[model samples]
Target chain A: MEATTEARVPQKLTSKGRATRARILEHAAELIYTKGVHATNNEQLRRAAGVSGSQLNHYFPTKESLVLAVIEWQAERVLAFHRSERFAHFESLDSLREWAGFYIAYEHSYREGCTLGSLASEIIKTDLDVRADLANAFEQWKDLFRDGLERMQRLGRISAEADPARLAHLLLSAFQGGMLLAQVARDITPLEDALRAAIDHVQTFAVLPAADAPEDR
Target chain B: MEATTEARVPQKLTSKGRATRARILEHAAELIYTKGVHATNNEQLRRAAGVSGSQLNHYFPTKESLVLAVIEWQAERVLAFHRSERFAHFESLDSLREWAGFYIAYEHSYREGCTLGSLASEIIKTDLDVRADLANAFEQWKDLFRDGLERMQRLGRISAEADPARLAHLLLSAFQGGMLLAQVARDITPLEDALRAAIDHVQTFAVLPAADAPEDR
Candidate 1:
């Protein structure tokens, strides 16, 4: 049985070493997301990253460590997208709908879905520590949505009666669930429907005349 | 690559043979859910079912066949619960709430989750045929929710403007997403919040004063 332990990273690297590590992380994330952690062995990762066996071992001593690093890497990528300029605030109904569209509009490759979510489903089968890392990723992702919803509430776009925290969870779960169903069914309709449902749910709490009412302005 | 073909079951079985098959499937499902499909070997299954090696092969022939059988078995179990006396018809708001509560009420064991969902997550990594079967199971499950919503619509409890099929997908996705998050987090809060959000969405389209209206009767 694998121990429930946190991943350890080696600090202090040269610039070239840092680039090599980033390259390996990039390739490893793709391999793990595409073919699951158990299926993607160290040799396969070494070849994919164009790294030697020693280098692979130096960065990630075990497959479990690589999986953990990939989780962190993917989490950062997802959060970065949400924190990007267009989606940064997520303070308006328009942006929220656009966010939903962003997910649904993408044409997925075969066997492709949310990177972190796919990893979570596979990783949850094994260790609690890994699962906890994933759970934390989800919590961070949920917080982004919550921050936006709270912003909207303060601006009077969303009603004070609605709980942003609960609504944020609904949005995150909707995305996770939609991705799972969409991936399994090989159809994006489930994802579209799920995201639409969540957005519609959020709209129910929208204050009327959310238009250009310049009361505060 | 595994062939994208459907599973084939033997046409004939004696009473004892059927019982043995059922016993094997029951045990296989338990092992598969707990330890994942890729991790559970045939030897482990034979031991778990207390069957001889030949006996296992006589029933399943291949591991893929066993997995397909387990998917069907778990689907039947889920559908049966929804089709049972208390949940049969599922034609009211109160019953819908009960259904949501049903999932949240259960205390899942360590590494335990939705039987078919866990299977689907693992099975999707291998074969398209297996994924299609899991997709069909989800379709049937979604149909159950749609059936109830349609019934409520006919009874004037649900608004004519609402789409039962879409709403059903929402409900199913919420449950799926909720379970995925709950399993990873080892907490039912995400599931609880998701179901409540979905139910609230459904209520937005509900017909007010859906009480004992004698005119409809």
Candidate 2:
């Protein structure tokens, strides 16, 4: 069992120290993402990050800490992408569709799979701290979607009976599953199908006027 | 990179040899399921299976072969469970609901997560061969549901407009996603919510008589 050096992360550091720390984390994230956590070792981290033993120890006292940092780094990047203007505001069906489209296109272009999701799948079962951190990350991600769905419900775009929290969870689950299937199949069809189904399910809740309901169907 | 010794597997084996091989595969599967593939090495496998190095080598010439064998073993078990009497033969909405119930129960009882899905999520990005094996496993699993849904369509339980293949993919994706989230959260709510949403989506296609349609809603 690797120990976590939570105290090692200092409250203050020089600009150069911060840059070095960031470089190490970035390199470690790439290796861990590509080769998995167990297969990655300290020696490889040192070689990839071009950091000395003392420098690595100064930033992360243990392998577990390094992995945790990577998880945090990846989570921030994923959340930032979701929070971008194109994906953040989802009050309308058109915006939701656009978000779905952007997700599929990004997945197709970046075939490495979801960074936080891949990390969560690999380590969540074994490491307690990592699992907690991942759970928090997922909750934060779900909140972003939930907030948008709540707006939709308030504006009467969707039915009053729709549960935003559960819908957000369902959509995220489908996205995670779709990413896993796409990575295994090395094709975009599973993701496309999953998102399409999710979006269509959302559409079912659309509060259409009686005059337009028959023609819309 | 791990070298695969494909040519080492002999074309013929006696009954005793087959039993020994099965024992090795069973042990490897257990370890891989609990600890993951990279963490389970040859020595642990030998100790757990109570097999000598030569015997282990006789059965599986490479680590890769053992992992692949474990994958095939797990895939067969999963497919068999799905094909059992309780889960098989879905010709009506009631049968589909029963299948969904069986799945949720199984997931709750076995808290480790979906065997093939866990394996797929962990190794899909790193190993092409493993990814191929997992993709085939998921396709076989999906085919079972697709067949059942097709039967429902043929029997007029579901509308003809429902695409069984796509729906099967959608449901399986949700199941995989739900299992992952449930494992991470250490709760069954995610799995329950995901399956309920999927089952409800499927019910939307039910072919109801005009007289009973309004009341059913």
Give the C-alpha miss distance for residue B72 in model 2, angstroms: 0.7
Sorted into a CAPRI-style docking class, model 2 comes out as: medium
Give a tens-digit lDDT track for model 1, residues B68-100: 888888887887788887775778878889988
Best by TM-score: 1
Tell how far residue A46 is off in model 2, in angstroms: 3.4
**A86-116, model 1: which lDDT tens digit per residue?**
8757888888888888888887522577888
Flag regions of model 2 displaced more than 4 Å. Answer: A1-8, A107-110, A209-217, B1-11, B107-110, B209-217
Interface RMSD for candidate number 1?
A: 1.2
Per residue, candidate 2 scores C-alpha lDDT tens digits across A1-217 of 0123234446587888888998999999999888878778788989999999999999999888888889888888888777888764777778778877877887442376678888888876564377777777788887887888899999888998877777776778778888888777778777777777877777778898666787866
Q: Pick the candidate with the highest DockQ.
A: 1
Interface C-alpha RMSD after superposing true interface residues, each candidate, one decimal? 1.2, 1.5
**Alpha-carbon lDDT, every model:** 0.80, 0.78
Model 1 CA deviation exceeding 4 Å by range: A1-8, A210-217, B1-8, B109-111, B210-217
